[model samples]
Target: MRSQFLIGSRAPSIEMLTWICGKPVFALQRGTIYIVALFSTICPHCPKTIADLGQLHEKYGDTGVVAFGVAAMERAATADEAGARVDTWLNKELPNPTISIAFEHTGEMNKLWWVASGSYGVPTIFIVDRDNSIAYIGYPDTEDPALLERVLTKVMDGSWDNSAEAKKAHEKWLQGALVRRANVALSIKDFKTALSTIEELNEAIPDNPQFREAHIKVLLEMMHDFEAGWIVLAGLARDAIEKNDGDWLLAAMQQLFGSPYDYSCLPSAERFSMGKVLSERILTLCPQQDGISRAISYGAVARYFYESGEINRAVDSIEHALELVEGESLPDGEKQNYLAPLVQALAEYKGSEIPREFAEDPQNRS
Candidate 1:
């Protein structure tokens, strides 16, 4: 896919309904470098990204650099809801937000900049040089903090546009853009297009497990091609075992037993066999003392046993998972996040009501 905006092109104008923080920002100032950050309140990583931009602004603002944050209403259902979400995030989550924040009600800002730059996700950064030319457009967190400092210094010095690092960054941005397009296709049920995009990504970055995972999902969940999916999954499972990657094994197990895919379509015998092998491998690789990992692994095993008509073993597995969580050292809120699901699962296994303390709705938690 071709990028919509290129380095050295004129930067897009900043347009929004109202400024949520600081003075109103109508456009880029003349003869000043600007760092424009695009984000959403719901994005898990936006807080850190915004915080980093704050630091960048603190260091460069006095030196003719300005920072602006545009928060898009990506997941909000209505304009009012969007405003409220942004308010909560600013007031509660980030009381002393260091950068200027703007709210986009109609997504005009996103279209003018994010779409124009082929950016498909939040926490994207765009740098506009003193001449109002786009100097950099990519994820801000892609580079190490030290490297990013050097790159920003170059941008301020008017030498980054033609730098070798800039060219490499652009190529990496293209790859990420391709992955984003593939995900969009998947979301819209365009299986053929998604598969083709993923295939191209696999060829471009064969070592990326993300593409492999996407390929498997498209095959198994979207296309319902169990034969092909199983082959790919078996290979991934083998690789995970060889690399001692418990995370990949757990992800595979979730794909086998979780939602958005009808695993019931696969033969029970084969499904159970795959589950047993994956669960065993995950358990072996994950140490018993690693409560979080052990909890998740045992949960997967419980799901497998529960589906295989082993009620007693299913309960036993879930109980083990809960026990591990009890010994975990996570903060109370975080521990509850983990315990809530296990408690809900245990209640389901025992055919009892979900306890009040653990009954916090998943949708409400976030």
Candidate 2:
């Protein structure tokens, strides 16, 4: 049997000491549906997930859904150290069910539930049924209220079916809103608004996965104040990482590459490090994936290397992608749209080796 680590597996119980409301909450029972968000106090996405969980807690507390946060402590001080971190942050945010801060049971819980042990990134969400069965598994965007609600509704309803018409409607609503809002924001050149809408869409529907890619595409095509927007995008990408959300992270990578802003212009090496991390994850997650997604990711890799001034790497990524893509056969502009960058990047690095039309000529400068 495939490992029952996903939905429908009996959840492993956690009996540990935690503090909530200035009182010790000991041996607290996991609710009918237990949301064990595997995260670390320092994980960039953890704080935002916690904050959103707080909001969800308020909305669903009476619905037999319990949101428990589990952070892996890798330091010497351990649980005490991690708990203090949670406490400091929790105090600043709205109060929700006791955020169970633990240090000791990290490995044990992972082994029991069959989750990959250690490396608890932020924004990881797990909604287990009251029967202690893992109902819904995947890193959800806690920031987006709609996405969070949709995920919780499925868990509370005791049905793990993500194919329900309701879920489709919810997704449609989110995507339509994001794409439409982005277009409107683009027309007006309100980059901040465009970025804000995209950010909200990402947070609301991190799992929709493609939504972030679309967001990045539009942002790159329209937005000008990329510096501030890029910072927000970084945090949002970090949030997707803790959730172990491969698709959203991939989308984030594509966006950075499509971005008009130059990563080399930034003084810090942080952007490059993040780009590398995201690229590795994408390769690990998406193998042989096709269509616009493959094109977008490839274009992104090319742009990432190009922005970092790795001209050779950029050229190679684009060239390989061109080989993979049957662009001449594609009728829609979408395929060609993504290929343009790679062609230009290749021209920049390899010069006349690329075709005349595809090469970076006077008109190719954007």
Candidate 3:
């Protein structure tokens, strides 16, 4: 569904049965510009978005711009469960509470706002003007923070919805929302719906790598059309190499090596051959100093080597990946997440059991 509340449309009422730190909040105070951030506590990116909102609130609170967070209820089984999760996240991850936090218990809030607006993911921000009209609905984080700040300023000044830039931003957001909806369809295994949605997106925005990636994923993994999928993958690889686009090359590698797709169904030799080519291209385009991308590329190449019975080459590749991880600066948890898997793979390659110290609890990582 496309968003019902467009740039000039009236925002849905904020009145809902919301729990704030285990207490009920009946309504948002009227007569102020409100930035309602719809997010999920479990989303890896939500914390940073929430922090950004908090900063926005701090900067504009006195100017009558209020930022509030509403955690979605999709993940939790009950209202109480959802409230508890929000409370924990607020306390641990976002302690200052610069912005009011609310836990959406019933799905009503989402149906009224998120679904009505065609937003399918967390961290979507909706701006409510002084008159309670919707001024903006899009991502909180942009490549240009100053541009977002200027938009927010205009939002508070009652000029954003009428601006040409607002129209452009809304159009861009709608396009992204369509892509997100297609991804949702793919996640639910509605391959036909996803296929059609992606095709529509591709036609609308021709040669978009994002749409192409989704199309290839559906073809190869869901439809089991290896012939068609390989053609797209090979073309993408060649295009990425020719353009020297490390990001697209990495995406191509993931299509072949990433989880959820059972590549064992394909001919091992051909799969390995494709993987080797993609990996070499990725390494050539993406330097070793690029850290995470390089590490991931190495891991993909290592997996290809291991499956091809080149045990020593696999060990070498994984070792180099692990060495890069060790030298890089990453959070302890994130470092553990990458290191544990690589170490486990190394142990398996060497015909030894995974060391207890290197084994990670899957439940703890996310």
Candidate 4:
């Protein structure tokens, strides 16, 4: 049931359209370990992943570890142009990074490494053991801070080879493949295939919140099959309320106002009605938490208030999010990054000019 290119399987040879840094590695040396990160120049999450990979290279280079970054998914005029963009981005974002860096122009790396391995999303990682078998394949980051180091250490000591750790990594990445299949199906407007994949995944991996939110998005937003979407979503809402589960309700709110779920075909009344219940439940579950983490929920709260014909409450929620972001020690640019959505929401809620303070004009800043 596992793909041929998997954990315990021989890693595909390193290939790059262009080498951006360090010694060019075309083949995997039998004695060396590797950390191959597939990232994108435009992917906001990639910078951190690349930085982490660089850190690992610094930590493990003397241990015969080969860490390299292959930049993929860059949209430029040509391979040369994309390579140039990656080169510039590295210089600015990661000057003198400790790892080898390459630019993927031909899309071969993507097909062979990412799509072939069944890994989902940007910042995919493949850690090759000394035997050249893929010891780990999945996201570079998780709740576990020392996950990479722990796994790398195991692989180096040969304890992870043919071990249970390898088996779990193999299973998890293969599960990601199901999500990848769903994404591919959705991309081509193959809603039927997408829905089937979602159902199969839900049965197999029910706790994946992103997939759960996405499943509802596909039904209610993409397929416009309100009948099917509500059948599951309404049941989910009732369960969340019955359990007084804030996390469940937060995931449910994505259906109403999440960026990915447009809800164009779903009646506004139905959308607003659901938003009101889910958002209120979230606040009720965690009322005393007014921190920035709680500020994220305010967008959905604002959506509910706006749709329920309480413009003032909606505006207040957006303003609170903006104020919280502003209070952070982040640079003005980063603050704008967080404030952009809230400001846009405020503009919608007010049904009038955006307050002069949050507008993009530099002169408006205090």
Predicted structure with the largest TM-score when compared to the true one: 1
lDDT per residue for candidate 3 within 3-114, as digits (tens), equals 3345557777667656584233355456888888888877888888878888898899889878878886545677778778788887888887667788677788888888
* Ranking of all candidate structures by their lDDT, best first: 1, 4, 3, 2
How many Å off is the CA of 101 in candidate 4?
24
lDDT of 2 by residue, 161-277 (tens): 555743554454445545566677778877777767777776766666565655555544455345654565676568656665656676677555555555454434676787878
Model 2 alpha-carbon drift over 4 Å, by segment: 1-164, 174-182, 189-203, 209-228, 240-246, 262-267, 290-296, 326-340, 359-366
Candidate 1 least-lDDT 10 residues: 1-10
Total clashes in model 2, counting residue pairs 3 or more apart in sequence or in different chains:
5
Q: Over the stretch 283-334, how does candidate 4's per-residue lDDT look in tens digits?
A: 7765656565567777667877876788898888888777777777778766
Please, what is the TM-score per model?
A: 0.55, 0.42, 0.55, 0.53
The prediction achieving the highest lDDT against the true structure is 1
The sequence of per-residue lDDT tens digits that candidate 1 reaches over residues 1-366 is 534355668887675556878766788877988888888877888888888888988998899988878886554567777777788988866788898988887878778888767787788888888888888787756657666667779988877878899877866876777778887887898999888888777766666666788888889877989888877766776666566677677766776775476666666676677777877787787675377878888887777777777878878988998888989888887888888888888888888999988798654775
Whole-model lDDT values for every prediction: 0.78, 0.59, 0.75, 0.76
Candidate 3 local accuracy as lDDT? 0.75
In model 4, which regions exceed 4 Å deviation? 1-171, 242-247, 257-276, 285-290, 355-366
Clashing pairs in 4: none
User: Weakest 10 consecutive residues, lDDT, candidate 2?
Assistant: 113-122
